[model samples]
Target: MSTPTSTDLVVGARPDHLISPHGVLDLRGSAGRDVWLSYPFDAAVVVCGLPGSGKSTLLRAWAASATVVDPRVTRTSFEARMPAWLPYASYRPWARLRHMHWLRGELRRGGPLLIHDCGSRSWMRGWLARTARRAGRPLHMVVLDVGAPEALSGQQARRRLASRRVFALHRRGLARFLRQVERGGQAQVPGISSVVVFDRGQRDRITAVRFGSRPS
Candidate 1:
């Protein structure tokens, strides 16, 4: 796959800025927060964000663009259409393990795979990093830092109203995940070598970091 052109890196220049027919767009970058972007055809990417922070939007956009870039590449949203075992609060721990196993298996057979979820969870990300290393595939992260206040409001007003139970669960999970990411600041997750901050004005803020390096 070719590198993302200067136009591709710029916001609104591409035909689909937020949600293209081929991909999804993340609007939370309008706020002065970080937005991470992976390589053009990374084998695996974990998109992290709170509810309404536009995780789905970013994943879809990436997926769409990937499809156009390389039809051979398959882009799937594992979190969006989660299996039944993942929803029940009681079985999340076990379900998470199972999901990781499944993801690893998929990567072993993959060309390009993207995992779109609230990957702010340190434990989950650690597991994914290990799995990526074992698979010898490069792992990248796209951290969407839409402040907690906006995320909470978006969840309550839009997400919660749509599905109160799911939204409530997501709310709690998001809070925990954000705290973990903030405390660790990307150092906790191995192989996450780059970060992009999507702030209030600048839509795309890409920064490169070495593996195990902390963001300044």
Candidate 2:
């Protein structure tokens, strides 16, 4: 594995700022406070982070209030029908294809959506950006930032550690993406209009993720 730089491992706390189609908002250093994020009714909110970076945890919370498209949920449903002893690795390709299909359907429907993804694939992000743009809906991203150690600990806690090679690839991809966002170059991400960053501690402070014109 490649050694990670400080910036690649941790994102410093920064105040919110928007440069038209690009915005950087950091949810950190807030104590005893709740954070609420609001967007238009048809916005597509993509939740991204490294493996075991609490992406699943946050998505679970939003599931009740939002239309969430989670790959894990698709995987779980697949597991429900298959034999219990069968490993997920065996049917991973099918599950991924199914997840993508679900995502495409959701994008086509064009309502408020909170999508869970690794944010490591430029092609996937590009496709999403293009689809949202064509539909005349804004695409937003919520990134969960955490160090490798903390992410690994989370994996251990969840008993679902990614393979070292896969994890390294995700780290490299996420690092490159974060570098661009932190540099105020989110416009470089094509149709991604905003990026909201949160460290593990700050992520827990989120009270609700409200969408549309209503107060959050």
Candidate 3:
């Protein structure tokens, strides 16, 4: 929704790499064009992290070749132009409302959807999974493993700090979710075809997001 800031940009990004190979789905009468379709991913891809865990940076890198649905982009844009007197809390609801509306529209249109999540709220995780499933698209999760101190430092660098309480809530939820993932708890999140884990270093190495590149 908003332009990616110079600092909040990924250096490199790439297409989603398939972990489990399978037959392609939903081809509209193409005789021998399999190579041209379903090369990247057929489901929604979500990148999750805490407030300052670099989700926006990654999205910016991916934006060039992918559809990245991020709420912070809009939020930041609004804050940039708003009067200093108006607290973000006053308009926070509207920002969230706009994000939800945009997300719905994007999903409806549907094709290689990419999302940025903060690993909070079980309801949202389930909802996204369900939506992708209903649309016959696989949902993949890219979780960033960042420590609290590091994330907080990132916030300081950005000149924005998330409320302690809110950040704590997100951290707790993320911890539990990550635990499940480590234990091979696939059932924890339904409709997830694969989970790609990334750390700060790995994320920094990304530069682009392509949608039709199959892995060899």
* Candidate with best lDDT: 2
Model 1 TM-score relative to the real fold: 0.55
**Structural similarity to truth (TM-score) of each candidate:** 0.55, 0.81, 0.72
In order, the Cα lDDT scores of the candidates are 0.49, 0.76, 0.64
Kindly indicate the candidate among 1 and 3 with the higher lDDT. Answer: 3
Worst 10 residues of 3 by lDDT: 21-30
Expressed as tens digits, the lDDT of each residue in 116-187 for candidate 2 is 999988888998898778777889888888868889999999999899999999999988887776675555
The alpha-carbon RMSD values of the candidates against the true structure, listed in the order shown, are: 10.4, 7.2, 11.1
lDDT string, candidate 3, 29-67, tens digits: 212211211224555678788888888777776766667
Top of the candidates by TM-score = 2
Query: Which is the winner by TM-score between candidate 1 and candidate 2?
Result: 2
When 2 and 3 are scored with TM-score, the better candidate is 2
Candidate 2, pairs of clashing residues: none
Residue 202 local lDDT, model 3: 55
Per-candidate clash tally: 18, 0, 8
